[model samples]
Target: MRDHTEFDSFAAFCDQSPWAFDDVADVRDVSRARLDEYVAGRTDFETWEEMKTRAAEEEIIDQIVS
Candidate 1:
């Protein structure tokens, strides 16, 4: 969406713990730099690999609904 408030709210939703989703709205409205900062500094993950590992370790990937 073009609205900043909508993008912010959506990004925050995506950052929730124990995330599980097969698809979401394209977030290109949010810059990659901002998204990376959110993941690295705000979230538990320092990198995408770490997020994947953690998800797999917790066995939530397959449990996620498509």
Candidate 2:
């Protein structure tokens, strides 16, 4: 959850792994830049794809509950 951080005019969040998720729809565009950091023995998750899948599941559940 990159803080739902966004870049209206193309700003970089990091020197190497920069990314911005303006909306959930934009989540389709996976940010592999930051993925290596997580996959390098820092978390249970191995890839951004896994995080996205779990997030998508939660979103669906939230919609149903709402």
Q: Candidate 1's residue-wise lDDT over 1-66, tens digit each?
A: 112122344345475523443345444455656655655764456654465466465566446753
Candidate 2 off by > 4 Å: 2-34, 39-44
* Local distance difference test, each candidate: 0.49, 0.49
Q: lDDT of model 2 at residue 41?
A: 40
List candidate 1 stretches off by more than 4 Å: 1-35, 60-66
* Per-candidate alpha-carbon RMSD to the true structure: 10.3, 7.1
Q: If candidate 1 were superposed on the true structure by all CA atoms, what would the RMSD be?
A: 10.3
lDDT of 2 by residue, 1-66 (tens): 343323222123232233455654554566565554533343345676664576688789889999
lDDT of 2 at 30: 62
Instruction: State how far residue 10 of model 2 sits from its true place (Å).
Output: 16
lDDT of 1 at 11: 42
Locate the minimum summed-lDDT window of 10 residues in model 2: 7-16
